[model samples]
Target chain A: MGRTSDAKERILSAAQALIELRGYSALGVAEICKAAGVPKGSFYYFFNSKEDLALAVIDEHWAGQRGNWQRILGDDDPPLQRLRRLFEATEADQRAGQQSCGTVSGCLFGNLTLEMSNQTEALRERLQQIFEAQVDMVEEVVAAARERGEVTVADTREAARSVVAQLEGQVLFAKLYNNTRRLDALWTNCLALLGAASPGRAQEAPVAPAR
Target chain B: MGRTSDAKERILSAAQALIELRGYSALGVAEICKAAGVPKGSFYYFFNSKEDLALAVIDEHWAGQRGNWQRILGDDDPPLQRLRRLFEATEADQRAGQQSCGTVSGCLFGNLTLEMSNQTEALRERLQQIFEAQVDMVEEVVAAARERGEVTVADTREAARSVVAQLEGQVLFAKLYNNTRRLDALWTNCLALLGAASPGRAQEAPVAPAR
Candidate 1:
């Protein structure tokens, strides 16, 4: 890649890490620049403003996710299994140090929305577009799930929406509680909502199960 | 109350609104002072730091949630019914024009854990305690569901945990998607999970007239 492209990628990656690490709100432009090993000029050289940088960071962040997310959501398995695999992959990322946990992303996007939703129609539209894209992506999987007979749910669309909500809530809890176990449980419930039980879902005797 | 005390309340309320409406990140002390109609010197006189003010904001926000939430979660009704009511309340809040839906609290508590979980040990412990407290609160009702035969699930504790994950997930989805509809579906599915199926639930659907 060209030097300019490398600098841009460096800035974006730094933003992702810090945003994931310290959050967009907590971390300042100086910190981002320090993390990226780039000068302030390079930062503003590429992005017009802090909000612009944040927007770019969000764009770059999700743009990177689309392909990985699609791969898992669009794998060779049945739609339901593909969905589970996608979550399992997410769980793996959470475990293997891929923070950002879209669940926690509300702090930035929703935070920005609160600050600018009134003043910046452009940002609001951008946020809406990103989220709609997510819902649509999920809707595609739910439609596939219906075709696959994996779930006899009454409404695939609503089910898809709930799955998104469920996944997002789990991320927040995981962050709050600093435990990934909820991720497992939430993913299991996702499958359950789609008519598939989580692995080892049945509760044993409240006492001990005799081996 | 003294004028200083009144200023504190104004600062707290202003901070709460701004944190929920704007964000906790660098919402300048000046902006808050302006919003609260308090003098800058008076603001500094009340709180030690912006974060100190933020903690107070969270406390106040939590207090505001108490009456409404207690009514929904701790009512003189079935645990399942109470649960559904809580979800319905979220729907009402969103439709009523408050953009700051608790669906995604941007959960100040959770957000702190995410940003500071790495740097500060005391904050880490505090965040864990908060989550445990909330989880315990929810588990109380989940335990009732177990005793009353409302929930046919095997393990009430696990069932309760599963429910919490869904609730948190719905919050994130609501905010990320900027809509409360998913929160509504989350309530419906949660009710179903607890075995309180209505006309919407598949199992509760009346048998088709002998076609």
Candidate 2:
């Protein structure tokens, strides 16, 4: 059972990486199995089809992301400060991806939504649910900020949606230009969207990681 | 020669439609030819490869969009009003797409950028160039608005980028949810981003088309 679980984990990780780098349509189950070094039998044992594996991958990916959001947005810092830290962490992750992959891959959910939303109803429905959950998380943070007087928003739900959209849009540009600098404006713009004060140029700079 | 040109036009139109619905990676040359009702031999006669055809499709699609933006954003209205009209036109188009296709397909450029930016450098470069031109158009409108004191923005270039990102991001949500109503807040948010006044909700609603 332990070995069985390990095989399943390997398949999911490999699928996520390939899908992130290339996209959902450009990959196939055979390639996924090859990348995972799992035999055909194990692949079938783990997933019924490519679509099934993709669904699992989406769930797994969101679970990890949900944890990250909870940690950053649910932190003990001021609500606005937590918002700032959330975007800073995103930029850091994209930079790390660029260093490893030679290009920044944008959000997997956004990528899949663009590629598969019209092609597969099942995938689209799953992606929509994931996005709604994400938006809910952002709305919670925005509501908290509003209650704390950290920002003034007429509608927290719309503000939260805008935050997700802005982040995804900027990340799309980063990938399109193959330049991480495109993301430098995200933190400031996010605050501006929330009617918060500018964090000052010095603090807006992407923090260099300690070696 | 006329017949040959007709076949080429058909191929490009078919490719664009299929790609917009399904995405760039899922459709193939054979499928594009079939949808166009052109033979495989004729497909190669007009374009060298799928990549070549895709380039032509991107150029053709952008040419049409460039015309729309110029007419709407370049009209003889106040700069701010022109900006509002531009987004209003976008909402109208997306709504039309929903009525026809039963789903809202977001910006083709943005959708392709998410899918192909990492896999193909040539396509990425083309998309980046097209986006730069689009941004330049927005910057010109923004600079004009600034000169007229229609709005105050610290950086016109960044402001234009934000507009594009925000619009693309919202359209992405519309596509993801298959809900055109997700776009209801675009014009208002756009005005807010520009530091301009809301046009009031009644006017903000997409203007009904004249018969």
Candidate 3:
């Protein structure tokens, strides 16, 4: 049974990697089957259609992020520290692995929404709901800072949403320009927003009080 | 001669609308040909290839923005006021039209870059040059604020690039959600970045204390 599931896991990972670069429309079943090194007969054994393949890609991507957030947020460090650490980790990860583009750029879910989400309202809602869940992950951290009396926000929920929005946008531009530095700017700005939205997020900056 | 040029204009406009929604790769030449009601031979006459057609669409879009800036930016109002006014105008325009998703969501240049720009350095550079040109336009406004004793920045050029980045990020999220409200949040955050980056810009804020 474990061996049976290994093929499915490999197929999902291969699809995630390909979908990030080529987009959902351009990625064909044949290409995925070839990339996964699975037979065409075996491809149908798991997914119902290309759409099913895409959802699996999104789900697998989501599943990975779940583990990622757990590590970043659960660290022993302070809330602000953990937040910055996550940003740095994201920058490093995006640059090293795959080297195709930003972790968030050309996301299979994003590509699906742009290309065919409207035609598939269920998929659209699912993507939106999933993305919102990611936003909530950030909100949890922001709220923790608030509890610690380390952060203040115009609206914690909105701030978290904005952070994710900026991160998502940064991914698109970074990939568009093929520069990892773009991701860095986004990381900086997100930190700025977190600080500015809070009372004092600039502990590292050494604020000199007005004389 | 005028009639011939208008037909060409109509063809280009139709192609732009379709391409933005579906992306350059998935947008069939035949589909564009059908939507524009231009014969395939006529398309060949106007554009040597689909890439050429895409290039023309980009040229047209840029030309339209130039004209738009002239009308809105050159209004008798001060530049800062004109800037806010233009934002309102853009917001209205998109709501009434295709939701201006310009350079925000699925930008044609951005979309094409992800799909084919990597295949050629010349094409990549062309697209990069175009993005830089867009950034330069926004820089003019930031520069004006600086000169008028109304803006300060650690780096105006960096600030300009970040503004472009923020706008790019926001638009993608906006289109992803199919909600203009999300887009407005991005615009608000962008202006806030401007405010934070330049001491000079803060005084121009609606509620800032007079200098």
Candidate 4:
């Protein structure tokens, strides 16, 4: 049982890494298996198909990141500050990814959605559920900020969607340009969208993750 | 010569359609040829390779859309109104696309960038050039708006890039949701970003193209 679980974890990690780097359709099961150091039979035994593995990848990836998100957005700081910290953390992640891979991979959900939304109904629905959940989290943050008068917006839901879209879009730009500065620009714009005063460039460093 | 040009046009159109609907890496030369009803030999005769054909598709697709952008952004209307008209036209185009294909196919440049930027350097550079050109046009409009005291922004270039990013990002959402209403929300948020007043939802129709 221990050995079997180890192989499953390896396959999930390998799929997440490769999918993040290349995309959904570009990478094959063979490459994923090779990267995971697992046999083909084990792959099928663990997951029914590549699509099933992708779904697991999404869930597993989000599961690992959800804690970071909850900690960042659920901080005791002012809502606006918490939002800034969340983006700062994102910038740090992108920078780390660039240093490791020579390219920023952007959001896995966004990448898969762009590549496979129209091609695969099951994958698209799964991604939509994940994004909707993320957007809800953003909405909650924005709503709290609005209640406290830290943020001003006519519609909190729309504002949240805009914030999420801006983040995804800027990440896409960073990946395309292979530069992290685009993320800083995105942060600045995000500040403006939230009706918060620009704190200048002094806040580019990633805040330490909450304990 | 006429027959040769006809075949070339057909191939370019088909490639654009397939690439926009799917993505760069997911579609192939043979599939494009089959869609265009052009023989494989004719496809090669018209373009050197699939990459060359992709470049041509970008060029041709932009050629078809540039006139609309110029007409909308270059109109005699106020800068804010012109910008609104530009977005409204974009929404109309997205709506039409959704109606025709039952899905929102986001911006071709953005879709390609996300899919192929890391894998294909030539294609990435070509896309960068095209995006830069588009950004230049946006900067011109934004600079003009700033000069006229219509749109107040700290930096014209950043504002223009933000606008482009927002447009690309929202289209991505529209594509992901398979819905056109996201475009409306994007326009509303864009107004907020530009510090323009919400002219409300009455202006959903495509503004008349400049004569």
Best by TM-score: 2
Cα displacement (angstroms), candidate 4, residue A125, comes to 1.4
Which residue pairs show backbone clashes in model 2? none
Runs of candidate 4 exceeding 4 Å displacement: A197-211, B197-211
- Residues B1-211 of candidate 4 have per-residue lDDT tens digits of 6888889889988888888887877777889989999899999898898889888888888887888888888888877677778888888898898888888887888888888887788887987887777777777887787687555565667667777888888888888888877777654555445544223321121111111
Against the true structure, what is each candidate's TM-score? 0.81, 0.92, 0.82, 0.90
> lDDT values of the candidates?
0.61, 0.80, 0.63, 0.76
Candidate 2 lDDT, B45-124, residue by residue in tens = 98999989989999999999999998988888988778778878888888898888788888989999999988888899
Model 1: chain B TM-score relative to the native chain B:
0.78
> Each candidate: fraction of true contacts kept?
0.28, 0.47, 0.20, 0.34
| Candidates 2 and 3, the one with greater DockQ | 2
- In model 3, what are the clashing residue pairs, if there are any? A152-A198, A169-B169, B150-B200, B151-B200, B151-B201, B152-B198
User: Ten consecutive residues with minimal summed lDDT in candidate 1 chain A?
Assistant: A202-211
Weakest 10 consecutive residues of candidate 3 chain B by summed lDDT? B202-211
lDDT (10s digit) by residue, model 1, range A1-211: 7778888889888887776666556678888888898888888889887678877877876787778878878777777777777777766766656354433332344334433443344666776676666667776887786676555556666666666656665665565555555576654566556543223331111111111
Query: In what order do the candidates fall by TM-score, top score first?
Result: 2, 4, 3, 1
Kindly report which residue stretches of model 1 are placed more than 4 angstroms away from their true locations once superposed.
A98-123, A197-211, B95-127, B195-211
Residue-level lDDT of model 2, residues A176-202, one tens digit each, is 987777777776666656654333321
TM-score of chain A of 3: 0.81
Select the stronger candidate by DockQ from 3 and 4. 4
Between candidates 2 and 4, name the one with more favorable lDDT.
2
Please report, as a residue range, the 10-residue window in candidate 1 chain B with the lowest summed lDDT: B202-211
Runs in model 2 deviating more than 4 A are A197-211, B197-211
Best by lDDT: 2
